[model samples]
Target: MLLHVSPARVGFFRAQLDTGRSGLVLCGPKSLQQARRLRNTEHFSGPLLVDPAVYEVRAASGEEPFPDVAEGTFGFEDPLAVSLAEQRAVGVTAPMTPTGYLHAEDSDALKAAVRRVAALDDPQVVFAAPVDVGWLREEDSVRQLIACLRLVRGPKALMLGGQRDPLAQHPRAVDHLRQIVTEVPGAALLRTDLAAFGALAAGAAFTAFGAGSRLRHIVAPGERAEKSKGFAQSPHVLFPELMDFFLGKTLADRFAGTAAPVCGCAACEGIRALDSFASNAGDRQARAAAHNVAVLMEWLRTLTALDSGPARQWWWYERCVAAVAQYPLLNAQLLQPNGFKVPAQLKRWALAAPAAVTVQPRADAKDYGRS
Candidate 1:
């Protein structure tokens, strides 16, 4: 399966070589240079997906889009910085939304960005990670964005992030997102975030991981080898410990699925469970990051190895039962065979506001917030 790594750079190539992976994910402004360097490096050969920056909503309460450099966004001056190198290396460019930049209201702006990006070079895949449940609920704008995306990048261009925790938000939000999934006419990357996997158990095109856990860890523990958050509360909810467990569970369950599993990466083959991941070599934070990476690789592998077969027959029955025992009503609908649906009230809430047109700059241009 394709193994999409993160942060395009010479170091990323080293990570690929170290792990013997064939797919890479390039993020931030340096993605282009990183992709090129990998092509030049004899140690590796693989395709690269570039996430220029992530765009997502700031809070769950309101419908607003903001630029979160902490979540990672390439700088304005270096928009095409990665383009020249990608051309030279004959590498692919897949612009992904940063951690918190994708808002439904930005559909028009997103389209414009896509158009500008597409003009630079014909990327292997044109993708966006729409994690904002707020935007997904806006049927008109979302459909419009989807149509435009399909037209620009064809059927496989758009990739939307799926439900993480169906129980975390109101029932209306869940329903709206599912409806958004049904209406969109492009490939999807169902990040099994917030126990939303059961909802996607039947026919998901792809899967991804939310940065909640990683983002949390960066702030909660200040564990960066050379980087630091400079002492600020992390907006991400996932705790490192929690991230380890969820990630491990997701992989082990999928590895032996009816649909032939795809991810081929170092972390997947190593760690077995979240607890095991937490103790698997290195410091506590290292193990946590490792676990997160492992699950992400597994997802990449699954997407790359998509095939015709029954979807993975999930067997987390016991864990699911326990979850139901605690969150019965919510879990019942989310895990129901028919899948969950967003309520009218939540739909109204999601559509309450529109996206603004102020292009703000990012903070970390050099390391995409790593530094």
Candidate 2:
């Protein structure tokens, strides 16, 4: 997975590079000023990307401006107006209106959007719409993606905005999503949010997530947003590689029981030994961000080095199995036996590792998919 860096988190990327960690960098900010600042200060020379702050655009359309719509955004175009959190500055796109997924029934609009973006100076333009995972289940999911792929002429990855898990967890969903991947074999796929990591096993080029762990999921989120922000922000811990998360825990809880010593990732080793907390939100968030990136980097390196689909599959499967074994909750929810069937390539690669591994079925298991 490529490390998608924002202007605010350039340090995370630089720190990883300075320490000899490997990852592909793609940089940009929703604002031209911030993007310019990142280019000038961070010396980030990678391809500039358009990070659509889709959250900035409210879904309910009306003639009046949204109350939360960032100020100063009155004339900004699609390429210019993308920031989600802050008030708009002069020339920024005003009150982005969240246009729901048009690709479902409006292929003409989707193509027009693609062609319009293809005309931009940036190497890649993220054509993201606030979409639910159910779009994959639509009859035309394959056709819709292929239509866009046909029109994209240059170096670019098509981003499907939405958390990938709800659709991805189901067997039919994988079949549908994988069809798009298979048909558009050369197209680069970008899945935003924490679930993006899961796409790697499904054949996406990269899985990108935002800075700070809390900003991880948005589309079809199973739960509500964190509602407990008070005068002081609590410290947090996350292990992206291990698929573990512990939010708003006290500093003392970090080292307690299985949580102590933190993650063993090289990135974590550097910060895990520190105070691990700060009264300031930025400091605490930055700490958690480092841990999250470190774990992801470790997994990225390991996955890339595997160098064979079957070998990669075998490795992924083994780690997932081990992870579920260690984190009991995962057994109930992730990489379930029913959701997996040994692909021909993976089965061939399975030979590289020991064959003692067997997927035994439970007596009460629902036949969620082929085992």
Candidate 3:
């Protein structure tokens, strides 16, 4: 499985390449434009995919072609952006969950949203996450979500999206996805955002975790709004699993060192000490982001190397479940299969919405809010 990590900015691409992890996703013109300058007009070799910013599909109301885009044109129309995407990207995607998560039972609603994406002639990938699937307590709901994926054909990548931060959305998300591609011949499951690496063991062809704190966590599809203020830089350290963010310079320093939990990614492994990651300026934030990706890369490499057999994917599924369940730190972030119940508010859409799931908190993190 290829673990594609996002660049925190155009500047971090080299750090990733220097580490030998490729297929860096250019978030858009914004990230791409800057990357170009940083490279001094150099070209990136691995497959580049453009996130067309269409993750949300319109709801069950009147269906239209990407209703969320301004003036009905996806920003991909920017001549410069289009040229760059076409020149560099393996493909471009319409947001898989443009209308947000759909109830597992709401097949009609899902078809309405997915039809346009399936019909597109451009090299495309389906980027969707079943709504409210995290709190899923019933097995039938899982079957229904798999059915929705089974319906999609002629696809490039089956990217799983829409889970909020720090919570395992649908515990069976990776399993069902593994089953889908096994039965369907065209596409491979590509999971993104929180817990994506875990999905890799469950059979993701490619998986990505957020490169920065801002990109790491997401509002549950149902709860997100149209607008929000940009986040200011803060002193924070990315923990293992990329779920929880511990905010504070002291905490960052304490956890970052050869003796600490930090991984030996290409970027930070060379840094001599954690104290060097002081929180005085953007340097701290950049280092933190690089460190997060580095550790994530190292972690993924380990998973990929665990088994070489045909059953390798299942090798991960079993390994991660047993491994995380015992490790207090991992359990603090992710959930074990059939582990816990989700919040009442989050569970409201579990069986009813077009997409949904719910999960309980780890023993130590009972105070964490379920998004």
Candidate 4:
């Protein structure tokens, strides 16, 4: 239940922190100064991860020429140097090395990155990669990456980045993620969306998603920016029942009935109707974001309480099944001709076989990264 928010939007999460349910806060490079200030001055004690976002710089093509972060933008030529700077700035004990998106065909680069990171000799280091989703779909690529990952003596994390949503494009993305987690006992999935919950059920060490749409998925190099120039973007409201997010205005239009769905999260205080989130009021948008985090945190707590692997898997499976069942009735209520299609990822979760339940002892810092 990690929440990824930009520096500007971090204040909106005060309500979430007050509950003490939020796990970790992840922000991009630009947030280094603010994050450090919060830790030193505000006395905020939660774990804060400042991602260098080197992947954005590396993923850009010659035409784009570092579309997001240009060379020397942060006064460092090496991306990992930028990440190390963030670690020092925030005083994080466990450091995560900055990495770039590696394509499936580039086995040489993958092995090189793994070997280089392992040479750092930091047992607490987190070896992370922004991987192309094609690797998940290709068995050979998954095997190759997993083998290389085994050589690194540290915790490993993968971020699926591309032009389109990996979970939507690759039907077996969750299955592949499960395989990786099974092979690498404490692997993490970062910068993801609802699919992360499935990863948790599959025994992933950690998972994170953005507070807004832009941070939810990592865009590949050369992909066109989705945001239009002048139009103001509306916050996306998460529909817990449907297990999907809809634009605030779109959700409002769909629930034209007298009673729209209502959220029971602490942020909403069990009184805010779903359509109310569509309002243009500034406070309403913040409330909507808070509501989203509350719902996710509550679900995470519920799953964690079900201690055994089998129990968690069964609980998540049933939840996905229920969400899939709601689409047909929702379309009928809206008087639309099947306008909504169940998300492929949700459908996969409902239909996939439950993974084998195993009990593995937690790996400590000393044991982590050992081949």
Candidate closest to the true structure, highest TM-score: 4
| Candidate 1: tens digits of C-alpha lDDT, residues 1-371 | 23333452234223323243334444445656666666666534544555444332231112222233342555553424443343445465344433233444656456555554455444444445443444555457556655655543422323333233322334454445444445554444432343233223323343333333322111111222233232122111111211223333332333233332232235434333332321223444343444345454443334224322222212212223333333334335335432223323323323322223243222221211000
Q: Indicate the worst ten consecutive residues by lDDT in candidate 4.
A: 362-371
**Residues 23-57, candidate 3, lDDT per residue (tens digit)?**
55445335445334333445555444444334333
- Cα lDDT tens digits, model 2, 169-243, are 334544454555545544444434433444565465444554543334343223344443442455445544234
Better of 3 and 4 by lDDT: 4
Every candidate's CA RMSD: 14.1, 10.2, 9.9, 6.5
TM-score of 3: 0.61
Q: Which candidate's lDDT is highest?
A: 4
Give the CA lDDT, 0 to 100, for residue 21 in model 1: 30
Model 4, CA-based lDDT: 0.69
Better of 1 and 4 by TM-score: 4
> Which residue runs of candidate 1 sit more than 4 Å off their true CA positions?
1-22, 54-90, 93-102, 110-131, 138-141, 155-167, 170-185, 190-207, 210-282, 292-310, 313-371
Clashes of each: 24, 3, 28, 2
List the candidates ranked by lDDT, beginning with the highest.
Answer: 4, 2, 3, 1
lDDT per residue (tens digit) for residues 1-371 in model 4 = 56767878877766665335344545665577767776798766766666656676575222221223544465436555556665776865356766766765567667667777778766677777777788898788788878888888877878887654676677777787788977885687877888677777778777776787777777775676465222144567888888888777767767765578777777777688788866656787788788887778778767666654666677678778988998998788778756567878888888876856564322221211001
